[model samples]
Target: MNPRPTPSPFSPIAIGPLTLKNRFIKSATNEGMSAQGVPSKQLVKLHSALVAGGTAMTTVAYCAVSSDGRTLPNQLTFTQSSLPHFKALTDGVHQAGGLASAQITHGGCFTFIRERSTKRPLSASGGFNKIGLMSGMFLKQAMTEADMQQVVREFAQGARLARQAGFDAVEIHMGHGYLLSQFISPMYNKRRDQYGGSLENRLRFPRQVLRAVLDAVGKDMAVICKYSVTEGVRAGNSAEDGAQIARMLEEEGAHLLVLSAGMNAESITTMFGSSFPKENRVQQKNKIIALAMAIQRRKEPTVEFRELYLLEHARKVRAAVKMPLAYLGGAKSLASIEKIMAEGFDLVAMGRVLLAENDYVNKLESGASRDSICTACNRCVAMMYTPGGTSCVLGQPGDAVLNSQQAASR
Candidate 1:
């Protein structure tokens, strides 16, 4: 038998012009700490904790390029009013010895548009987001050519704002059936214009956005993209399609590719690990959301726990693209990270594990823990929909009640 390959989590790797001390990144998971479209002290504390805990890079997630693109009322957006807040966030990360990345997105029909826009939410074609619809979003409009151009400009402006705020990287959100992913996924995009129908056409808008971001930032900051390997429906993009998408992103100059799976409507659990506890919903008291969850669970259900769940699919994307790839799934152990490194992935990102144990990276690096202690209970996932922002419920149970109440008040 061949010898086992050595693991290199501590090795330095270049993602564009930024050199990370280690391959571990705290992948973007919205903390819900932003209110009034700016980062709060709580957001600073969250980023500081992760950086202090030994993450080489920490991603501030779900900053909308435009207000109408916000999926949550408290979500951050790139705007003149929010500049100082973002600056404080990146400054804190840099001081803590971790590079900062901002994940910029346009939520499309997935957002609460009435809060920010007079016009209807835009999509490749008009349709309702089941979750949003249940939450009172009743109408959507297909994107006109001018609307698409404006979105591309919005992404570029977001990147420019990220650079001004001192971020080392900008992660363009093209996954999870968000704006760009909605255009890329065949199940959602039903337009017959030059921007839809065929796979290449479906890629057109996303490509434009990617190009605009690259042009805006150039070599001043790294550009990364998150995209799905599968949209997780009967008639969605498959792994082969993912490979093609990866190549397309590399061609358009993505410094790194974050390979994830699942879409918003059907298979959200696949995008993030889910063992959603029922008590969480009861605590939050949102019946419509609970009903939607029930419907989705009955239809697609949460995928069972497995080590490196996306590794096989990510390998397909790796072979297809020449850029550095970051692996995101249920990686909670050094052993899993080693296996991923041995397979030649350039980076490993953790979401739930980090949410559960902020110092997990330090623990693994010090050899103090063999694996993360997170149970994947996903009460934290429930909390995101609540007003508590996000906190691990392992040691503090009352946090659930307090947080849910706060969310209701909001």
Candidate 2:
């Protein structure tokens, strides 16, 4: 018998009970399109454009499980009052013929906005809260058993809210030095409790949280996870550790795994290659934090942008798990997309490329373009804090106008 040919990147594929139209998914890159935890029209328009442009699914990034989980004052928080906004956002994406996934996460001890929470942010262990320094929250408290249970409940509730809001899937954010990542990384999690110490122990709380999320929404919506393959810092979770984490997620009934790397607090450049612009550095509001960031910039090794930058780390994870896997990071061209598919990745999750050209997918399918024009200049990284939200500095004219209007309104 003749062998069947490999499926094309544009072919349909199933993730859990959900089947996407194509293999291209828009990865979650924080879009600061929410004001006071409510989704804006811009947020809906952005995903609608991606789907209209041929993306199979577009992720609604950083939807915090609770008000206290927000990383910024403008970040989305899943709640009954916000359901209509989220529903509208999802309705727009569906109308454009695409699936919508919500990336649910918590800031934990790494937050600048703390007034919303009744108490200090919770972490795996109590210690200095570097990210909270600018906000005058110099320290974080350890998560008590009660706190852990509450967080787990919050995650489950968030997943339920995502489903109610019309999301086809929920991408649990367990990476980028967020709440779960803190627990997974030895560098940040230092405690003698069952939730700390060895890698297996570190996996406990995260696993409990994952189990709760799956139980809440796995039967109806796909349960995907975006996790770091490496923290990209000293004494952080290594590639090997990440592989084990992937295995655990698979065993816990996760439908898909999105491979990511680096920590927002320590090695963010590793997550998005290249350095921030000098102008962006100068714009930092906190002089003390700005100086510290400048020093850290000098100490950290430069990470140049390259096609399929995280593929090497992803390969280790691919070898470790049998679940469907989505590859994120540095995929910017038809050649790169084909390469990722050939390497056994089930989906190609593009961020900057899509931000640079939302219609790039349609263009590629129509043979109008083969590669994205994005230079990976890291300008969009800074734009996440801007009023208009994260957008390409090179080609998004509409976003430019939005930014201007937002700045003026401010």
Candidate 3:
């Protein structure tokens, strides 16, 4: 007998040397469940539940390559000390019947400057970030050649560590205004070096990082890149540039391209899904910074919710590159998911909806209701800053009660 063919969306497919069970990936959403740059039991439990709930693969989000590279102090870091915890997390996910991926990241200047005091934050250029300055952080120092090469080495080392930790794949975060993203976006990269002139120059460091990661991991595990298609603001990466970037990533031997957009400093609301809720905003401890956030929040542009919001943009990327493309954006409801899958995207990456409904893929498989109940209110996005970690406010009613009870006791 012949082997079975892969199904669309539900089909098992090969990404590099790894085969995912289905075309559904739990996009890298901040879990805020780690502690002191180490994965906790809570992190393990979260990924396990997501895997058991029917995601083909659940990604461990925002694992930093180094201590100072983190956007938050509590993020997961791939380091000698963190090895066991990461291994446990991946082991638990695999035991739950899903492939596991780690999203390796470095926040660059956006690494939350307030967290580090010994040295200034690193950026592609030595300059002030308006958002950083507004938050009382001084100008970031430009990355020296040594600094750049060291970071590339860290990325490669992170990938190798992920493979050792039992991850089926590693997703390089090359988007969302993180360190790699800063080098790619002209908005933050103003250097005059080989790493910062035209698009090719802007791509220099990212390509180097990708090459190093590929060399480190070889074909042992899949290597995917989560990249922004555009910043969705003037003077940022345009659609054309995004397409070019996707093509470049393909040439660099990336197994998959997860296309997303928006620069946190540019139009944060676009990346964030909806307007930043005033109620959920963590009151800045510093008065000046609190005032700055208040002013910026009021001025932020809000994008209305639309099904498959980024499908068109992702389609452009699909056209540009032959590598497997994962489409991310507003994918809720059966109609929208089917629309996204039918558009030739190899996978549909869900974030907020999965936060709202962990078993959505199972629901799809079981011939149950086709529509997703997630409201996309984005309150969970705010919970990443809370001490309790990210939890759906409306989706999990029991969590709400537990939180309220905890608050009352405190």
Give residue 252's lDDT in candidate 2 (0 to 100): 87
What is the C-alpha lDDT profile of model 2 across 148-241, one tens digit per residue? 9999999999999999999999998999888998899998899898888988899899999899999999899999999999888877988989
lDDT of 3 by residue, 1-410 (tens): 11223246777888899888888999998876776677766667677888898899998899888877887656678887678778878888989999999999988888553766336788888877665665466678789888989999999999999988889999999998898999999888898878998998999999999999999995798899998898888888987899999989998899998888887666766675566667645643435435544765877865667777777677788778778888888888777777666666778899888888888899988878688888777777666555556778875422322222211122
lDDT ranking from best candidate downward: 2, 1, 3
Per-residue error for 323 in candidate 3, Å, reads 0.7
lDDT of 1 by residue, 1-410 (tens): 11335448978888888899889999998776775678766677678789889999999999999878887676789987688878888888888889999999999888755765545678888866554666676777899999999889999999999999989999999999898988999988999989899888999999999899989996889899999987766799988899999988888888999888998677877776564566765676556557666666667654668878787788888777667899999888888998888877889988889888888888888888878887777777666655557777875422333333211122
Q: Where does model 3 exceed 4 Å of error?
A: 1-7, 113-118, 282-296, 397-410
Candidate 3 collision pairs:
7-11
Best by lDDT: 2
Superior by TM-score: candidate 2 or candidate 3? 2
Q: Each candidate's lDDT (Cα)?
A: 0.81, 0.85, 0.79
State TM-scores per candidate. 0.92, 0.93, 0.91
